[model samples]
Target: IAARLVISQRTAQGHVEHILSKLGFTSRAQVAAWVVEERQSSS
Candidate 1:
């Protein structure tokens, strides 16, 4: 994501962590699972 966005890896990680915190997630896997569910539901 950092490479695609032209940001430092640490910066990308920080953004992801912040988002997960706001959404009550403790790990990236949780976020990934939620995203998959959300997309499936929307579809």
Candidate 2:
């Protein structure tokens, strides 16, 4: 993800961690699942 975003590894991790904290998510897997569910519902 850091490579794709052209950022440092720690920066990428920090962004993810911040988002998860704000959303009350425990892991990236939870975010992925929520995104998939949202897409399906919107479709």
Candidate 3:
């Protein structure tokens, strides 16, 4: 996914860390679950 975005892996990882910290999430799974729930609700 980072490659596809044309960003370095480290950059992508940093972005993920920033997102997790801002959202108060401990893991990617929690973020993914929240995204899915949000999408479902919007639809």
Candidate 4:
């Protein structure tokens, strides 16, 4: 989301952390996979 939003790398990292905490995910890879799955489903 931060990448798409054109935010800095550090900001993106922060967003990833927040997302992981909110979603109960332990890894950024899991969050990335979820984002991909979500986009595919929405499309």
Output the number of the lDDT-best candidate.
2
Model 1 misplaced stretches (Cα beyond 4 Å): 35-43
Residue 19 in model 4: lDDT: 79
Query: What do the candidate models score in CA lDDT, each in turn?
Result: 0.94, 0.97, 0.94, 0.88
Tell me the tens digit of each residue's lDDT in model 4 across 1-43: 6668899888988877887899999897887899999999999
- Can you tell me which runs of candidate 4 are displaced by over 4 Å? 1-19
Cα-lDDT of candidate 3 = 0.94
RMSD in Å for model 4: 4.8
TM-score list, all predictions: 0.69, 0.66, 0.64, 0.52
Best-to-worst order by TM-score is 1, 2, 3, 4
The residue-level lDDT of candidate 2 at 25 comes to 99
lDDT of 2 by residue, 1-43 (tens): 9999999999999999999999999898999999999999999
| Candidate 2 vs 4: which has more TM-score | 2
Largest TM-score belongs to which candidate? 1
Per residue, candidate 3 scores C-alpha lDDT tens digits across 1-43 of 7999999999999998998999999899998999999999999
The C-alpha local distance difference test score for the whole of candidate 4 amounts to 0.88
RMSD of model 3, in Å?
2.4
